[model samples]
Target: MTNLLLLALSAAAAVAPADNGGAPQQGLLPSSPWNVDYAEAECRLSRTFGAGADGYTLRIIRGANLKGVQYVVAGQSLKIRDWNHSGTLGLRPGERAYKLMVAWYRLPTGESAFQLLADDALRPDEIASTRGLVMEFDGAEPLVFAVGNLEKPLAALASCYDDLLTGWGIDPADIRNLKTAPDPLDLHTWHLYDDAWIGKAEKGKIWMSVRLDVSETGKAVGCHTLSPSGSAEVDTKVCVLSVKNARFKPAISTAGDKVKAPFILKIQIREQPATR
Candidate 1:
């Protein structure tokens, strides 16, 4: 997910944050303009903070249905100590801190990075103010970016997201006044839950965000994966199983008519917890 409001931490070698040993904060100036990537599989928007550093990026990604988001951060001096490399992160526009979950990720440059996911703490619209981002990690120095309002940039992003839905064969008009979002037919799709466990990675977890194109008659007509990383076999199975087993209640319009709509699902694949 693009960090739409990520006035994030210090970054990798290319754009690492200032190494302030005992400094109180790593304050950054809004450096670059917002960049939106309309990729084949995802809609990502990003911007660089901290004096226009190449890697000082604040990227937030909205899901296909716009119900949730994911964000990524890369800090050069970030240290990891926990068994799962997980930590608590705080983001605030002014005073109230928004709590979020932070996890480790490997940047394409082979450096370590951090990311946040779809937890209740991050209510994007609530925190998406123009005040920029003030990020805090427990005992570490604060990461600050003096960015102004975000209303315009986010509007552009919403436009891009609508265009993406069209590309996936889902009508943008269908969701404008949706009385109900599509509901999953089952609690667990065994095909998907089972396929996710085969030959899983040795460590960490992967997030899979998928889009389902549901017809007015409550049938899945198309499937798309917003996250293109990880095993191709599992990716293929996601679509295959979706068509065969992924069922949903057709979205209802405010006019009391069933309408074709895009359904979104974000799932996490990780090792089953140790049950003694």
Candidate 2:
């Protein structure tokens, strides 16, 4: 529910192909070959739906184009809904939007393939509104890819429910009763940001990156810092990263002599298990 990824995007304003109906394109144009080797790359994504007798299930796939990846809904039958190409296909009204899952496989060639990256459920608003959802891939060969699905109506309804809950700030009675379902093939993408204060007068720009990893549960871990601007002395003793939302908060220091004029704290949110 937290918009951590959106915050990362605000920092890195990089460009990629349009998410709409654009033709299949390769990585960043006029850029050097991605030097980073991703032989051991992985990624995963999940969303929680309202509790009910009939729970929700969602899946996602990433590729050079929608046609490349193969999938089946509620069954093993290979169905080419072509949600991406058709521009308007996968949606069911009054249903929740399903989560997307993606994995990167090692290719026969030493150079890895950034294609066929992720697959996910589509929100109706996302379908009826934008061309498609664009995802940013980081590594040796960083690239941007688009995804589309007909399941927008279901996603839209689910989104409405989320808005209602968030707006009312109502704690569902079943909050503690929620559980994570089994996922045989887990793939997900995570974005990381490097933030620091340049000086007392100005905040430094934020640096960003992404990581693909298998889904799991763990404690949040990382280093946080506050850099000084100009000649101001920096005191970085009081910085904290929010565990619930992966946000950073700088603590005020009473060390008068050690106080720096222009400094900002750099906070890093380590990976942790995803839970409702």
Candidate 3:
């Protein structure tokens, strides 16, 4: 989906947790403090926690063809150091844990948000039926929530997910073989040498970012530069090369099926002096 919230939610479904032995037994979980609200038009199922300064919202949104989860944290500031590539968020009921990749963003309301995503649909039963919810992220201490009843809320969320897919004419079976998109470029090969681009390559200090939408045939349909690398010529060159020269390993939706996907490229072009 084009919306950031939906994108994040779809990602959450992509990497769902497996039933490891420690999942909470199917029964009535302890009373949770979470409050649920459904927005059928948007296909969103949400739960709010902590009011005012210490508040956060947990959301599961159904996108055009994907599902995702968002943890919106507010009433505080986040330091750059708080975000590390190695940081992961874990959700556990009992001891069975589901680890998810975490991405951070700033909301228009000025609140900071963290998202967990994958590229597939999530099984609502796994989460709704579990109890004793505890979440751990980024080396910080675990946060425990009183998640009393998950059955009804998760069921509603699942329904919204189905509604989105059906409304968009997508079949769930077609998504089974879908795998996350991967980068095709060996960026190291593109780092300019001192003699390559002459003046531009002398220092090679260029910071640029690009976004690409790839077709199922492994071709980049469109590419746009997000940040310029100082030189217009250099910027244009990078985008052109990425779209024309880069080879992509098409995203597979089935053993023999390929699906369209989006890819992002961020490069800080800098030269390295000879070590010897």
Candidate 4:
């Protein structure tokens, strides 16, 4: 796993100023054309790079809200020994690089993968104007790829995100000029039970999609589980805890006025291992 110190160092040493001009190969591996998927509750963009033992698939996923874009990499190339690592993402023709904490996930294919969930998402303009991406991990060498034109794919994903909002009774038009989506004012309080209780149940993970009705005051007036977690008790616990701790910064308009809006999130809950 990459450490924060090394991640920062790599960014400064390797990342360069991005522009509409294509990124230097810099040993950047060739990649497949970008693919878009309108999943059950998320939008996904993915591509594969490298060959043989060095091959890997990179996936970008966004849920119902405007933030929390997750970057996932899967393949036999990277081993997962820890729950977290430090990683960086740099865009081609993009000036700044983003550092993130990468968490491990085992895919259905039994491949070990690392996931980096970004707190902020790039604007649609940025996505459309980009041509490649650079990713770095501590123990492994960086993976650079020519991601191809994303204008149409990104627009389709935006439409998918809007459709997700509509499912929550939100009108896409009402969210125009949105400055920020709802986020926890106090991260500590928000995570106290962000994962539903599974202490007495099976040992696997429970995934659920949830929607929160945020009042103008940023209070969670209502919480609803839009997707099932396989257990009724687990689902109830998730909503109950989420509502009690939902002090958030309500969505803000570009004009700086706070507006009541629904926020959607995809949550994964697993039984915490007992500590000695």
Candidate 5:
């Protein structure tokens, strides 16, 4: 992880200005060769840098469709001029040291989520005032990262953010209370139950299961479980939820002379109803 962080920092530091002659012309496509395509009828843009005499030229181009473009350098948001169309951004000779990328998407509903990617793996010291999700990658170039999905790399980032908060002595309740983006793992409810138990003088056995639901709004609504007797119990009372992850266990007892068996009950959470 430390090595990956050093590599990313080095890459960010290596960004340099393009030579005078190779600077992309006003009407030409952005100088970089990387491209992005949006499959859901949305606009996309990609940026790439090219080696030039002085350093490199950064080219950013619009997708087949026009979507707005914004960049964050040193934590400051800069609205790219003439970004409605393709354009070249001239990096000052020493200014290639910028290390962060903040991409903003104007969702179909006018809501937006900022996708923050760092050139360096985030160190505990680097995230002091950070208020959003953080992710780390340790692989080849054209490195990929994402957010807002349970199975994607961003999920790991969400976990890191939670850990950072905890490590800093920040109260989890306060962290959750802060106005932030909706949780991707908006689990409404989680349930765990045992089916049946069989016990003998020599051996015992048990069964267990769990269920949960996530909503479009990224909020978990209901979580519950049933005991072997088919009685409903609020599972949250016995579990601690950290961001999207949770840990829990049930109460059980065993006697030396008498073998005891336990069966898990049932657990279920309500998911968002399917759209017609």
Candidate 6:
């Protein structure tokens, strides 16, 4: 990871600015290459970076006073309870640096979550024009993100964000309170009891908490166990099944605008003896 970050940064540094003869017109594309999904009153713009299936998923969600993007790498098997750290954001190669908070969640299997936040929500043009982003996680290998050719997608996202804000009669940068908390996750919806897990259940209770990154559509794009259950299978199963089966009411802002937010799902599985 360290080597990859260094090499990518060096390459970004070597590229010279395009010469438009004056004012350095970048000739950014008119459209963005990203995909957008709207649910639960929020709009989620997503795009994947890097090659193969091993890259990362970049997700943007709008909130009351906060709007940020999350970097997700799949198939990470780290079982750490929780982590809170600070990091630096290097944008446009040698451009000015921004301070960001690093929050991560380690889930079942090999899945990991890392989120980045700026002091305030960044505009669409700022995000689209950024050629490269280097996320320096403290004491860990930094990850390089490529953000070229995103004009059209970002423009679309910006328009969508503005439209939503305008419809709510709120400023683009203002914050609001949640009108109502998001709905709780319903395990039965996914038929979790039908899984082999129920067959292996003993006379003990299994309790687990899952951190969910719920999208605008009320779908969980990412799920991680908040704490370990003595049983790895139970922990993993709960996290995996919840993402697929769990449902939320979708959070609403005080201004009557729907948005995406992080939610915690608590689950308790209790076994009963067979009754003849």
Candidate closest to the true structure, highest lDDT: 4
Write down the TM-score for model 6: 0.45
User: How do all models score by TM-score?
Assistant: 0.60, 0.19, 0.50, 0.74, 0.19, 0.45
Which digits, one per residue and each the tens of the lDDT, describe model 6 over residues 1-276? 444344333433333343332211221111234777653334567766543323455666553223444433322321222444777876663455787776665433345556665544455666666775556655443445556655676667666766655554445544336555466556567654434654454436454455676776788778765544456787777778777777776777777776776565555464323211
Question: Looking at candidate 1, what is the lDDT of residue 136?
Answer: 53
On TM-score, the candidate that comes out on top is: 4
Q: In model 4, which runs have C-alpha deviations exceeding 4 angstroms? A: 1-33, 81-85, 93-95, 138-140, 185-205, 271-276
Candidate 1 lDDT tens digits, 166-276: 776666676557767676687475357664454552244455767878788777788887774377767777778887887788877889888777787666665433321
What tens digits encode model 3's per-residue C-alpha lDDT throughout 133-161? 44445544343434555677667766665
Which 10-residue window in model 1 sums to the lowest lDDT? Answer: 1-10
> Predictions ranked by lDDT, top down?
4, 1, 6, 3, 5, 2
**What TM-score number comes out for model 2?**
0.19
Better by TM-score, candidate 6 or 5: 6
Q: Going through the candidates in order, what is the number of backbone clashes in each?
A: 11, 35, 15, 3, 13, 12
lDDT tens readout by residue for model 4, 1-276: 353233323432343433334334432344577677777677787777665445678778877655568888777645664734788887766565789878876775666677877876776777877786777666554556566676776776677777876776778776666778887677566663533365633446555677888888999888887776767787777678778886887888888999887777667666333321
**Candidate lDDT values, in order:** 0.59, 0.25, 0.49, 0.68, 0.27, 0.53
RMSD of each: 8.1, 20.9, 12.0, 5.9, 20.2, 12.7
* Runs with alpha carbons beyond 4 Å of true place in candidate 1: 1-26, 51-55, 80-93, 118-129, 176-189, 193-210, 214-237, 247-260, 265-276
**Which candidate do you rate higher for lDDT, 1 or 4?**
4
Tens digit per residue, CA lDDT, model 5, 1-276: 233334333433344222454321121122344334332211233333222321122212211111112321110111212222221222222223233444433322232223433222323432332221222122311211111112223233334444533443334344333222222222244322222212211121121122222233333333322222122232333222321453222112222121111111222232212221
**Angstrom error at residue 230, model 6:** 29
